[model samples]
Target chain A: MFLESKRGILFVKPMADVPSLTISPSSKESGEWVQPSPPRPLPISSLRTLTIRRWFWWVGVSLVLAVVTLLTCLGFGTESISFSRIWFILVGVMLGTESIHVGTDPTAVILLQVRLPRVLLAFFVGGSLAMVGVALQALLRNPLADPFIIGISSGAALGAAIALLFGVGISVWSVSALPVCAFAGALLALLIMYRISSLGHGFSIYTLLLAGVVLNAIFSAFIMFLTSVADPNRAFGMYAWLMGSLTGPDFFTLGVLALYLGVGLMVLATQAQSLNLLTLGEETARSLGVEVERVKKLVFIAAALLTGAVVSFSGIIGFVGLIVPHAVRLVVSADHRLLLPVAGFVGGMFLMLADTVARTALSPGEFPVGVVTALVGGPVFLYLLTNRSMRVGM
Target chain B: MVDSKNVFSGPAYALRDVTFGYATRAYDQSESVLKDLTCSIDSGKILGILGPNGSGKSTLLKLLARILRPERGTIELFGNPLSLLFQADVARRVALVPQETMQVFPFTIAEMVLMGRFPHHRGWGGWHWEDAEDWRIAHKAMEDLDVTHLGSRLVTDVSGGERQRAVIARALTQEPQVLLLDEPTAFLDLHHQLDIARILRRLNRERSLTVILVSHDLNLASQYCDQLMLLHHGHIVEVGSPQDILRPDLLETVYGCQVLVDRHPQSGLPRVSLPV
Candidate 1:
C-alpha cells in the first residue's frame, strides 16, 4: 500500500532523485530464467588497469631488466663478465671507442653476439604471445581461451614437429621457417576448431571451447607419438625447443621477429572497439550494424598470427600468453582497446623478467625460458581461476 | 518512394501457410513447431498474440523477424513479401524485445539504445550526427517510458525491467516503423506492465507504427492492444477487439482454463482473470 502511494505520487510527477530505471523484485515474472549471479573480480578491468598504469612502469622495469638480462646472459654462465666493466664495454661498442676494451675478449663476444640476441628474442616472443592471448580472450569472450588451453600451442608444436621431422621448416623458413611453419600449424588447428564449433546459425562459445578441448587432445596425442619415435639427436633439440629457450637465437632472427610482432600488435590495438563490442555476444554486435563475423575473422587471424609468429620461434613457451593478459585485465577493466597494447608491453616485461630468472635461477647452467614462464604463470593462472572467474565470465 | 495512395488499411502482416521448427539436429526439420499456421496483424494497432506454452507465439515472432525462415508459406510485412525487406531493412520496419534473454557483458544504456540506429546508418565509419538524432529520439523514448535516468547505467548491472527498457530503448534507437516484441513485460511489475503498454500505445498513436507483440498477461494485453489474436496448437483461431477475444469461452478454449472476464473501469476493455 505504501509503495503504491509513492508510485501514485510519482505517476503524476516523475522524481529526479530515483534511478530512472528499476526492475522489481518480481520473481513470479521470470517463467524460467533464474540465473544465479556468478562470482566477481573481472580480469578485463585488472588487465585494463595494468595496461594503463603498468605499461610505462612495466616497460621501465623491462628496460632495466632488458639490459641486465642481456648482460647476465653473458656473465652468469662459464662466460661471466664483471658488473663494472660490462657498462663500458657496452658504451665502447655504442660510441665506437675501440681504445676502451675494459673486458676480457670471450665475455665481449658472448655479450654482443650470443646473449643479446637470445634475451631480445625472449622479449619479443613473450610479448607477442601475451598480446595474442589478450586478443583471443577478448575475441572469444572466454578467459580460458588462451593458445595453450585451446590447443593453439600444440598446433604450432605439431607443425614444428612435422617440419622438423622432414627438415622442411628450416628449408622453407630459410631462417624463420620453423616459426612460420609452427604459426601455420596453429592457425590450421584454430580454423578447424572454428569450423567444427560453428553450428550454422551463430557461433556458440560453449561449442568453441568443447572443440578446443577435443582438438587439443588429438594434437597432443599426435605430438607425443611423434616425439616418442624421433631420432635421438633431433629429439633432443625438439624436446629442448618444446620446453622453450631464450638461450641462443641468431640476431637476424630476433630482429625479424621483433619487426613482425610489432606490426601484429599494432593491428590488434587498432581494432579494440570491435573487440569490446564483441564481448557482448553476436546479436548485440549485429544490432549495432557491425559485421560481426568479419570482425571475428580479423581478430582471430591477428591473434593467430601473433601466436603463430611467436610460437614458430620460441617453440611453445607456455602460460605467459594465458596469465599476462588476465593479470593486466584485473587492474584496468574489460575495455579491450586499452587491454591489447597494455598486455603487449607487460607481456614484453614479463618475458624479459622470466628470462632473467631462467638465466639466474640455475646459474652457471641454464633452464629453458619456457619452463620459467610456466613456473611463474601456472600458479598465477590457477589463483586467478579460483578467485576471479565468476566475475570475469559475467 | 512507396506508393502511399494505394496503401492497404488492413493488417500490416499476413502469414499464409507458415511452418517452423527448432533445430534439434542438423537434419531434424520434420516436427514443425508452427504447422501451416496463418495470421495477420493490421496496421497502426497494438495486436497481442496469446497462447499456452509451446503454442508457437515465439516461433511466429522469429518467422516475422526472419531470424527463423518458415519451411513453407509467405509472411508479408506491411503487405509486402518479408524477403523484399532486408533483415536490416525489416529491422527498420519492426523492432523486437525478446523474452528470456540475458546479456553476458556490460554495455551502457545509451550504447545499447544507440544500436537501434544500425539499419539507418550508412558508410563504414559507423554512427553519425543524424544517428545522434536517432539517439535524441531514443532519449525521448526513454524519457516517455520513464527510463531516461538509465542512460549511463550498464545494461548488465540493471534489473530485469530496467534491462527490458534498455532493450526497448535499443529497438527505439532503430527508429523502427513497426515493433515486434516477445513477452516484453514478463519480468516487470504491474506498474511497469502498464508503463510499457502506455508507451506502446503512444508510439502507435503518434507514429502510426504497426505494433505486433506476444504477451502472456491477457489483462495487460486487453488493456493495451487494439486487437487480440487467440492462438492454440500452432494456429491463430480467432481475431477481434479485446472485447470479442477476451470472452470466457474463447479464453477457456485457448488456455484450457476458466478466466473471469469483466469490463475495466478505466478503458472499458475486457479484463481477464484466472479463477481462484
Candidate 2:
C-alpha cells in the first residue's frame, strides 16, 4: 500500500520523465491536457458497469426471493396446509374458475381470507418502511437515520392510538380512520421538526435528529397515557397493536397501503439522482443545481407518508427500514435508482419470512413481527457499527 | 465598438456596494462579513483573491455563486441582475469548489464528477440519467485535472491532493463559463499546486473560462493570476496586475508582515519571499 501510494504521488507530478524537484509548469502545453486519452478500458468506467450489472443481479435475486417468500408464508399458519394445496388454491383463486367451499375445507377460507392478506400486508408494509428508511437516510445524509429514529413512526403510532382509543374519525371504507389519523400525526411531527431545525441554517440534521428523539419519547408517553385510561379489553388491543401486529387489517386496508407505497416509491425514485448528489453534502448538491430546500421538502413528505401508511396498519414494525437499506447497499451501489427498489424488495422478503416465523414460533399464540425484527435488527445494527468496513463506508 | 447588448460586452461578474452576512436565525440578522465591496471581473481573466484567514475570501466566492444573498447591493452576472436568474440558471453558468467538503457517505470519484453535470441534464422530473456525451465530458475533465487514475477510488479514500484534483475534475465537468475555487491548492503538494495553476491557466486561455480563485499562496497568485485582488478585513486593498499588486508595502500592510517581492528567476512574474 505504501509503495503504491508513493508511486501515485510521483505519478501526480504532471510529467513522469521530469525529476521531482526541478519540475516546471512551463514544460507542459495547455491544450494537450484537455484532450481525451485514447479509449482504454478505464477502471472507473469498468467499475461502473460492474456496479450496474451487480445491481441488476441483486434485483433479480430479490424478486425471486419475494415470490418464494410469498408462497412459503401461505403454508405456515396455525393449521398447517400443504404447499401443493396452497399453490392449487392460489392458482385457482387467481384464475377465478375453481371454487372451494369454505364449509367443507376450512383450510380454504383460512388460507384465502386470513393468511393471504396478512402475508401480503406484511410484505407491503415492510417494503414501504424500507423505502421510507432509504429516503430518510439519504435526505439526512446519515447512515443511521430511519423513520423510527426521526419520530415519524412514533408519531404515526400516536395517531393510530388516538384513533383507536378516542374514536377520532368515522369508519369510512375509502380512507380508513386509523391511517388518516396516523398520516395527520406524522405530518404534524414532520412540520414541527422542519420548523425547529430550520431555525438556524437551512435544516441542521443534528438538530432535526435530536428533535426527533425528544418527540418520539413524548409521543410514546402519550400512547402510554392513552393505554392506561382505556378499558381492559381496549388496553389489551392497544398493547398488541403497539407490539406491531399484522393480524387486523383486511384486503381493503392492504389495497390502500399498496397504492400509497406505490406512489411514494415513484416520487422517491424520481429524486434518486438528486439524492445521490445530496449525499455529497447540501452545499455541493446546491452547487450542482439541486434546489436543496425543495428536494428536502419533497423527500420528507414522501417518507412521512410512506411511514404513516405502513405504521397505521402494521403498528410500527421496527428496523426493516434501517437494516434492509444497509444490507442492500452492501451488495448494490448507493445509487438511489437501484437502492430504493432493491431495499423494498429485500425488505418485503425479509418481513414476510419474519412474519412466517412469528406465526409458527409458538404454534397458535404468535409473536409480534416487531419483536422479531428488533431481536434480529439490534445485533445487526451493532455489528454494522462495530464492523470496520461498514464504519468507514459510513 | 463593443455591442452593449452582447453577453460578453461587460465584466462577467459585477458586485456593486455589496454588503452580506449570514443570518443566525430565521429573523435574527448577524453582523456583516463583507461591507460595501465593489469589484468587476472581466471575461477570460484569471483573478486570484488573496486574503488572510476569516477575511471573507470564501464568502466572496459564495456571494458570486449566489449561495448567500447579499443584505445590501446588487450582483450582476453577465449584465443581468442576479435576482433575475434562477438558481439553476446561475449553477449552469457558475461552479464553485469549496475549500473542504464533509462527505458522510462514500462515492466513487467518477460518480462524484458525474454529479457536476446535474445542471446540464435537460429534464424537469424523474431520474435524469446521464447520456454518453455527459460521460465523455466527465472523463475529459478527469484527464484535464490528471485524476483519471483515481476515478474508480472512493472519494473519501484518496490522498488529500488526489481528492483536491478529483474535486477540480468535478468542477470542470460543470462546463461552466466561469470557475470559482476557494483554496483549491491548500491541500495539494507543490507539484500538484503548479499543475492546477497550469491547468487553470490553460482553461482560461483555450476555453475562455473566467476564473476566480482564493488562495493564501502569494507566490502562486503572483505567478499565474492575470489580476490580483487583495482583501483585508472584508475590504479590497488592491486590484491590479501581479506586478502592481505584489509589492512589499501593500502586502505588508494587508498581511501585517514583512515580505520581499521580486521577479521570478525564469517566468518574470512577481515572487514573494519572506526575509529569513
Candidate 3:
C-alpha cells in the first residue's frame, strides 16, 4: 500500500525532474540537451513480495512448457508416435487402465520403458546442473563459474572411468558402483579445492579456481590412461558415456537420481537468502549477519552433490548449468529464491529439447546429447562473455 | 523509534589492550595491524578514528564490528563481552558500513537497503522474509537518505553518491544502536559528504545513536566528530575533542605531512589543511 503512492508519484513526476536532480557542470557546459525519460517504477516492495509473485507466474508457465516438451520429445524418436497415442499411453499408464505388453504393442513398451525414462532423466540432470551453476556462480561471485568449468565433472568422470575399468558394476550387488564412485570422486575434488583455498585463512576464489583447473587436468589424464588400457568394447562404451549420452536409464535409476537431486535442491533452497547476501561480498555478507564460513561450506557441499549426482547419471553435459542461470537471471531478478527454481525448470525444458534433437536429427544413428548442448551452449557463452550488456551483474 | 534513554547504561564500547594481526607464512610471527589499542567510546557520541593508510583504522573498525577477533585483550559492548555474543546478536545491535562495496549481482537499491533487515527476521534459522513492519522501516530509511526515488534502480547503475546513500540507508535499516563506518565519505563529492555527515549527526541527536567512523579526511572528521582519536603505526597518538586533537604539531607528528590547523570561520570547529 505504501509503495502504491510512491510508484504513483514516481510516474506522475515530469521526466525533466529526473535529469535536473543530477545536473552537473560538465553537462551544462557541453550544451547537449539532456533526454527526459520517466524513471523506472520501484517494485511493489523491497522485500521481493511482488517479484516472488512474478516468479510463481513464471514457474507456472515453465511447468506447462516442461509438460509440453516432455510429450513432444517422447514422440520424436526413430519410431515416431502420434501425440494422441502418446498422451493416451501416458494417461492410461497413470490410470492403470491399459496394460503394457511387449508382444501386443511394442510402441507402448518403447514409449513407457525407453523414451519416458530417458526424457525424465534428461530433465532431472539438466535441472540439477543448472541449480549447481547458480549456486557456484553465487558462491564464487564470478559469472563464469559452473560445474564443468570448476572441474567437478572431470572428477566424477574419472571416478566413473575407474569403475568401468575395474568392472565394479558387473558384480550383482554393486550395480550402483559407478555412481557411488563418481560421487566420491566429486566430493574428493571439492574437499581438495576447499582445503587449498582455505589455507590462506578463508576460501580464496582465485586459489579455488586454480586448484580446480589443475585438478581437472590431472583427472582427465587419469581417465584417458584408464580408457586406453581397458578392453576395446568396454572402452567404447565408456567413451560414449563420457561424451554424455542419455540412454538406457530405467525408472529405478531415475528414482534414485531424483532422490539425490531433491535432497540437494532442498538444501540449496534453504540457503537462497544467504546466497543473495553472499554475492555482495563475504565481508559485507558477514556484517549483514550471515555466517559466511558456514554458508560457503554448505553451498560448496550442496553444489558438489548436485554436480556429482548429475554427472554420474549424464556424463559432463556442458553449458546448460552456465547458460540457463544467466538467461533466467536476465528474465528474473538475481534474487536466488526466484532464480534457482525458475532456472531449474528452464534448464530441464532446454535439455529435454536438446536430447530430442540429438536423438532424431540423424535417424537410426544418435549422437551424444553433450554434442548438442556444447554446440548451442558454447556460442551462447561466448556471446555472453563478449557482449558488455549481457555480463551478469559484474 | 530508538529509545533516547541509555538502555545499556555505560560506554558504547570499551576496549582493553586489544591487539590484532594477520597470520604470516612463518608460524612464529604475524604481521601486527593494531597494537595494544585501549579506548572507550562514550554512549551516543560520534567518535572518529583518523590515521594514514595502513595505520589500522579499518582494522580497528573491523574489530569493533566483530568482523575480526582481537588476539589479545578484550572488547566490551555496552558492558558485555563482545566475544560472548553470537554474530547475529552483535549484528542486531551494531551495524557496519564499509568504505565501498563490490557487488556481483545487480540488486535494486530497495532490495539492497532491505538487506539490513536480515538480522531482524523471525523464523527458524532466520529463514523468513521481511514482514510489513520491516518494509515500512526500510521505506523510511530510503526516504531519510533521499533514495526513495532511486529505489528501483540497480545499485551498480546508480551514481557513487546515490550508492553511498543507499549503503547508509541499509545500515540504518538495521535499527542499530551503534554504527561503525569505514571512510563514510571517502570518494563522495562535497555535497554527498556533507549530506552523509549531517544525516549521521541528525541520527545521533534524534536516536542517541553511537557512531564510530574511520576516516582519512581530517577536516570532515574535525567538523562532524564529537571526539577524535588519532593513530600512528598501529598505536593511538591522541584521543580528545577536535580542538585538542587537531593541533598542528600533533597532526604533523601523526600524519608526517599536515601543516595548517585553524578554526573554521563559520562553525569555529578546528580545521586541518595541508601547506603547499
lDDT of 1 by residue, B219-268 (tens): 88888888888778787788898888888998788788888988899878
Among these predictions, the greatest DockQ belongs to: 3
Model 1 error, position B36 (Å): 4.4
Scoring only the second chain, what is candidate 3's TM-score?
Answer: 0.94
What is the C-alpha lDDT profile of model 2 across B1-276, one tens digit per residue? 222234557799899999987755546544338889998999889999998777788889988887777889999988878777766777778888888865655566777888888887756432566767888888899988877766656665678788888888889998888899999999988888889999999999999899999999988888889999988888888899999999899888888899998889999988999999
- Cα RMSD for candidate 1? 9.3
In model 3, the runs with Cα more than 4 Å from the true position are A1-52, A99-103, A167-175, A191-213, A389-394, B1-6, B25-32
**Alpha carbon lDDT at A290, candidate 3:** 86
Candidate 3, B130-243: lDDT as tens digits = 667888888889877878878766666678778888999999999999999998898789877888999999999999999999998889998899999998889999899999
DockQ of each: 0.16, 0.33, 0.42
Best by lDDT: 3
Clashing pairs in 3: none
Candidate 2: where is the Cα deviation over 4 Å? Answer: A1-45, A49-58, A99-104, A172-174, A191-212, A387-394, B1-7, B25-32, B124-126
Which candidate do you rate higher for lDDT, 1 or 2? Answer: 2
Q: Taking the tens digit of each residue's C-alpha lDDT, what string does model 1 give over A1-394?
A: 2322232233222333333343446754765555443222122121111123444565465457555655554455456677766786778788886332344676677777766676668768877887788777766666657787678888988887888877783654356566667778888887876566455535455566677778888987987788789888888888887777776677677777777677677677766666665665555554444566676777677777777777767777888878877666544334565566566666776887788778777767778877788778778766655653234333
DockQ preference between candidates 1 and 3, better one: 3
Q: Write the per-residue lDDT of candidate 3 for residues A37-137, one digit (tens) a residue.
A: 34443444433332546767878888898899899999999999999999988889879876644425889988988899999999999888899889888
